[model samples]
Target chain A: MKKYKGYLIDLDGTMYKGTEKIEAASDFVKALAEKQIPYLFVTNNSSRTPEQVAEKLTEFDIPTTKDHIFTTSQATANFISGKKSNASVYVIGEEGIRDSIVEKGLQINDMNPEFVVIGIDREITYEKLSIACLAVRQGATFISTNGDIAIPTERGLLPGNGALTSVITVSTGVQPIFIGKPESIIMEQALKVVGTSLEDTLMVGDNYDTDIMAGMNTGLDTLLVHTGVTTVEMLQSIERKPTYTVGSLEEWIEKM
Target chain B: MKKYKGYLIDLDGTMYKGTEKIEAASDFVKALAEKQIPYLFVTNNSSRTPEQVAEKLTEFDIPTTKDHIFTTSQATANFISGKKSNASVYVIGEEGIRDSIVEKGLQINDMNPEFVVIGIDREITYEKLSIACLAVRQGATFISTNGDIAIPTERGLLPGNGALTSVITVSTGVQPIFIGKPESIIMEQALKVVGTSLEDTLMVGDNYDTDIMAGMNTGLDTLLVHTGVTTVEMLQSIERKPTYTVGSLEEWIEKM
Candidate 1:
């Protein structure tokens, strides 16, 4: 399309799931590569790193690197860095989240930190929770990667970092500055990275809440796929319908 | 206890699952029954009626009746009735949604409806969406039950009626009068039904976005159950922590 030069795509549900790649997804990427089209696999789930996501894509035979991936974690980190260039922080999270916070050259400490950056920490303990609440209540600007309370999986929906954010919110009565999907924060970053105009580019996602809304909110076209969290029936029933519906990434490429 | 004399509790995900009862959820009602507690079952899920929810509860061995139930459909109907007295409504919904529209003593027709009452209609048609959008754009007061974008199920998360409202919102830039949980619309009715003082009454549900927030928005003490849409981790991590946390309704009895 003459109107668009690049695309901003979502991972987890939009691309390969685990080691199993969706049919035509690889071929579509190959086509993009052959056509010299640029795309970034962005995700709101901040628990993983872009490197990790890229690795997963590589395993599925989709050639990728960290440069082609963007995450809510990254955006949050960038936002934090921009807002607080010299702030010390207490990180309630894992290596990925910790790295995101520390990557900005900001200090990470448990003792009287300037901010409490709450990310997805699987090993989160009561002490960490208490410390996070304390930090925020003490005026530390609490920020989170995304508000996805639960993540959908093949098994079922699992409580994501949104669950933790909820607890911290209740204790502090302060909502974290969210920097992920369906929010203007991450979309701005994606738009910058791809250098794609919103009108021409499309947001391909399986979730209506995050993906579709993100695109629609940013004035981009939206493509809904049934292979992820939401079904076509679900989309049809809703008052807000996406711009286009596809069965999978393969069908999406066919249309493209 | 000193202030409120009754209660109005939402049913879907709060009272029962697809066909199962929430833990100790019945005991709370039974305790109310023993103490001659006045409570009503209010729900935003228009998929069924008060009769169905009551029957499902009875099947689980918790006796309930139509008199003790109020649906958003019912609430919206009452709201419309109180406001317009008698006006024709362009109803975009199911049997429950339709019946509620009529309950307001309003005539239902697509010809020249003065207002548009939007609800979660499973068999949604493109024609309906267009009509509602047109009607709202034409200066009709648009009303919605809730803004819940997704509904969780055994299968997966489906686009809830809230998504419908979003579509209309984006198109018209007009927000509807939301009358469901977390909005303080129906929760007021629930309070009236239970005859419980706002100071002593407690709300327990599994969803943080609706059930718990509904209580938080109101002055009622809230207990977040971990059985349905929300989990233990979510309860622990939120910034808007509930008054109390329990793994299940059964665990709630232990608190008492």
Candidate 2:
């Protein structure tokens, strides 16, 4: 087995499932830490900040800090800042995305903006959607944190950011630049943050479509763990397989 | 021009534009009343009740009664009633759609509904959308009032019913049955209300896309009036033209 210098991990499914902690997750991180391998929790969750995510991971006995978290919100803000510093933006999201944009010194403007950014907003309203549509029609560059169609909860699968984003896309006839998983944008940003060469870094997650595809799209080797969404039976139908597949993160600890 | 036995007229673009009334609309409807011709106002607005719409038309000096108004809300309710009498429905709209559903003796159920219907809702919330999405995913038949992408307002073109509907459609990967203009559903309902045979009825309106296309789709002769949305220059680009083209409703008043 090839030794990886750094790791890009996925949350929700990989690190934990909803509010429940994955049994093998803590030990796997400990193994990586003992070897002094740097790893970042690359997540598509744009609702909560890194501090919040780190706190949750800490409760699960997983060694984590705010610096170890790299959410899609941060990637979206970074992408915008790379294009133009201090650009005016119309945002439709919660605290995480808003804070990230503000952290980058981007101006939040409702009337007229250079860009329109949308993230998962559980408090979403028709007025917010109307403002987004009007701005997009006025030639604002549209951007979404992620393209997650449905979010799993105790209640069942609910409409995700992708579903909400479709309102503006369908209305204004404008396609938004998605900055999260399965796209190279967030992966590239994560790679830069993790501070490792693509060849020496491994993308580890349980989702084939988002995490694995994101790694493949970014020219990084991927390890698919079966502890979450994608199962062994489900992966058999896929043509291109992940570089490594394991029943749990515990199985990969020996190799690491 | 061929004489028509009945007339199906559009409301917003044909009769009035926002708070302003069209100059030729009153004289045209008055001519229909004078000739004792049966004319029904067909509107895609699922927000306002037929009585409210009729009151507005009467205020504009157009001879209108609640009986002469046929809105998409009524059409949608009629459609649902035709499928299953007293069927439970999950509706996301204003008073118009809700009133029409109750008038049809249909039960409104948020949990485990037989049908999930969506109309234009200015007071739309994420919770309402989440309920609709959950219902649709749980095998409820999905229906939308209209597929008009944007609504013209004092502010600008705002997100329409179609845009709001996309959230569920995109999330659930299920296409909804649209019940408004450009679809034969609303036109068929309007024909029954107006007591008009498809061959002898004339569909009249200012918007070529909705009114004329609805007529064409329903096999009715269409008269496109250049008072609102569709202009003379715009009509030149369309390959399939309306049966009759007039500069204003006044031009057709003499023919009626």
Candidate 3:
């Protein structure tokens, strides 16, 4: 087995399942911590800030800090800042995405913006979608944090940012640049934040579509754990196989 | 020119354009009345009730009554009732859709609904979308009032019901049964209301994509007026042409 110098991990499925703790997750992270291997939690969730995500991981007894988190919100802000410094933007999202854009010095303008960014917004209104459509129609660059269609919640699968983003896309006839998993944009940014070369980094997650495809998109090795979402049966149906597959993260600790 | 016994006219672009009256609309409708031809105003707009739409057309000096107005909302309610009388429906729309459903004696149910209907809603919220998604995922039949992507307003083209419907469609991975123009559903229902045979009725409108296409879809002869969306230059590009093309309704008054 090839030894990875650093690791990029997923949040909801890999580290924990919703609010419940995964038994192998704590041990797996502790192994990485003891070995002094840098690992960052790369999450597509743009609703919550790094601090909030770190706190949740900490509650689960996983060694985490604000620096250890890399959200799609941060990736989106980084992407926009790279394009134009202090660009005017029309945003439709929660505090996480809003704060990230503002922290990067992007101006939030409802009218005549240079860019339109959409993230997961539970407090979303028709007015927000209307503004986004109008802005996109006016030739604003459209961007979305991620393209996850349904978000798994205790209540059931709810509409994700990708679903909400479709309103503006359909209305204005403009496709948005998605900056999350399965896209190289978020993966490349996560690699830089994790301070790891693409070849030396291992992307670990339970989702075959998002996490594994994201690693493949960014030219990194992927480890699929069967703790959530994709099972062994699901993997057999897929043509492209992950670099490694395990029943739990604990199975990979010795190799790491 | 073939003499049509009845007419199904469009409202927005044919009758009036956003509170502004079309000059040729009044004389044309008066001619229809004078000739004693049975006519009904067919509209894709599901946000307003028949009475409200009739009131607006009356204000525009067109001979219109609630009985002479057929809206997509009414078509949707009728569609649902035809499937199952008093069927439980989960709706995400404005007063027009809600009232139409209730008037048809359909029960409004958020939890465990038999059908999920979407229409244009200025007051749409995330919770409404969430409920619709959940209901659709739970096997409720999804229905959209119209597939119009954008609504032209004084400000600009805003997100229409189709755009809003995409949120639920994309999230739930379920396609909705669209009940408006370009689909034969609304036209078939409007034909029943207008008391006209398909061969004897002329579908008249300014928009080729909606009104003319609706006519074509339902096997009705179409007259495309160059007053709104589809222009002379735009019509030249289309392979399929309307049965008749006129500069204004005034030109057709003589034919009536």
Each candidate's B-chain TM-score, in sequence, is: 0.90, 0.99, 0.99
Q: For candidate 3, write residues A1-256 as lDDT tens digits.
A: 8999999999998999999999999999999999999999999999999999899999999999999999999999999999999999999999899999999999999989999999999988988988888889889999999999999999999999889999998888899999999898999998998897888999999999999999999889999999999999999999999999999898899998
* Candidate 2 segments whose C-alpha is farther than 4 A from its true place: none
TM-score of each model, paired residue for residue: 0.51, 0.98, 0.99
Which residue runs of candidate 1 sit more than 4 Å off their true CA positions?
A1-3, A153-155, B1-256
Q: What is the C-alpha lDDT profile of model 3 across B177-209, one tens digit per residue?
A: 999998999999999999979999999999989
Residues B83-131 of candidate 2: C-alpha lDDT, one tens digit per residue: 9999999999999999999999999999999999999999888899999
How far does residue A31 in candidate 3 sit from its true spot (Å)? 0.6
Return the candidate ranking by TM-score, descending. 3, 2, 1
Better of 1 and 2 by TM-score: 2
Backbone clashes in model 3, listed as residue pairs:
none
Q: What is candidate 2's CA lDDT for residue A92?
A: 94
Model 2 alpha-carbon miss at residue B89, Å: 1.2
Query: Per-residue lDDT for B142-206 in model 1, tens only?
Result: 88877665555453344567655554565455678888888887887677666667876777677
The deviation in Å at residue A112 for candidate 2 is 0.6
What's the C-alpha lDDT at position B177 in model 3?
100
